[model samples]
Target: MSKGKAHAALTIAGSDSGGGAGIQADLKTFSALGVFGTSAITAITAQNTQDVTAVEPISNEVVAAQIKAVLDDIRIHAVKIGMLGSPALIETVAQSLKDFDGPVVLDPVMLSKSGVALLPNDAVEALVSILVPRATVLTPNLPEAAKILGEDEARGDDAVLAQGHKILDLGAKAVVMKGGHAEGETCRDWLVTPEGATHLDAPRIETRNTHGTGCTLSSAIAAELAKGADLEAALTRAHGWLHGAIQAADQIDIGHGHGPVHHFHEVWT
Candidate 1:
């Protein structure tokens, strides 16, 4: 490593006591992609693989302090954000990242893997107004898109594209709508930008080890961005990484309900 080389990526998110999602997953993804990972925890959750029992959000001032400390000391090349518990936390993060010029990957994390709601209902507006505009790429699942647009309609490629446009209209440079939760053999993800939309299709891996897929994908994208790939290229590489992670998931067992993906699949090779 060079003396002044920038090799760090920051994750602003919540803590998962289960170690399957949020900051835990983000840091694991970063390390798997060979980047130093830093974190600013927004909230703490008492969760297991099956459910989230409790949540306690950290103070806004502490969140701001963590961001400032990391930014001032480390050379952060990219950022991946997830699970802002409340409107106040969202606004605090927005203020902290107002001048950061790195690649920002925003994962619109609304619910836990166990179907527990992680974000507050009123925080959606604050996230759109404060953080969406500053994101280099925003990753949202179908349900999150529905919540953002305030619609109860079923999501397809066309509907997701329209919602992506709505997200872009809100000020994101690009939008990635993940179709894993959709019904199909193929999990199709769309990356919509000002130029046009590019579709990424991959066969959905049928497994119970999908607890942190969203967090892993976004963090992998940020790691690729830190390595100097373009937006589309980063997304493509992230897709590949996530596919491997899922395929190798069966090699280990962590929790009884839904386990985490294998982040060290290539380490022994």
Candidate 2:
């Protein structure tokens, strides 16, 4: 068995009262991948499988304090960011992460599982300006990509790639535009960078347990990066891991609406 001080991954996001997405999902993904997890919650979400009824934004000072409390003491190898609930929080987190010289996986979580907007319209500009440029990798679904690109380009793979390139122009080092919501038998996730583009296509597993998919994917990517994988390798591994997670979740039932993925599907002794 491995024995040493556990390397850490910090997740800066929101609290999911349902324990399926946001900070909860991030922590679960980190733990399942054998990384010690820490968090700086930016919001408190009254959310479940069906909807998010309310969101209470955490104070920016407190969010910065949480980030400092972790980074000051622990040797955090990677960081995953999700769900900045407001423009102030976005600016706060972007500033905090600017000094964190580590692999940072950013999941642009703009909406809830039940199609509720988690981020306000005003915060989009802050996120684009402050956070996107510093990200080691940015993960955004088709709709979120559309929102960021200021158009609905979620219809075709080529259009999605075009939008991904547009996002790259915004300054992210790498962009992984997810194709889960796209109409197809296979789910294709595209990874684009200045070097070129790589495609990860997997057979779509029909299952309801996809609540925390974006969080899980970004956390898993951070996990792989913490374990010393490069951007392409990390994205590939995270894609397969999440595919397995979804497949393993097929037999389980967590809620009447979308359920949580099986993040620990590969656990063994």
Q: Please identify model 1 stretches exceeding 4 Å from their true place.
A: 1-6
| Candidate 1 lDDT by residue in tens digits, 1-269 | 56767588999999999998899999999998888999999998998788889999899999999999999999899999998988888888988998899999999999888889888789999998889999999999889988987986446777888988988999999999888889989999999999999999999888999889999999999999998899999999999889898988888888898998888776745
lDDT of each: 0.90, 0.89
- Give candidate 2 regions above 4 Å deviation: 1-3
Clashes of 2: 0
* Cα RMSD to the true fold for all candidates: 1.3, 1.4
What is candidate 2's lDDT per residue for 17-114, written digit by digit as tens? 98889999999998888788999999999988877898998999999999999999999999999999788888889888768899989899998999
Clashes of each: 0, 0
Candidate 2 RMSD computed on C-alpha atoms after optimal superposition onto the true structure? 1.4
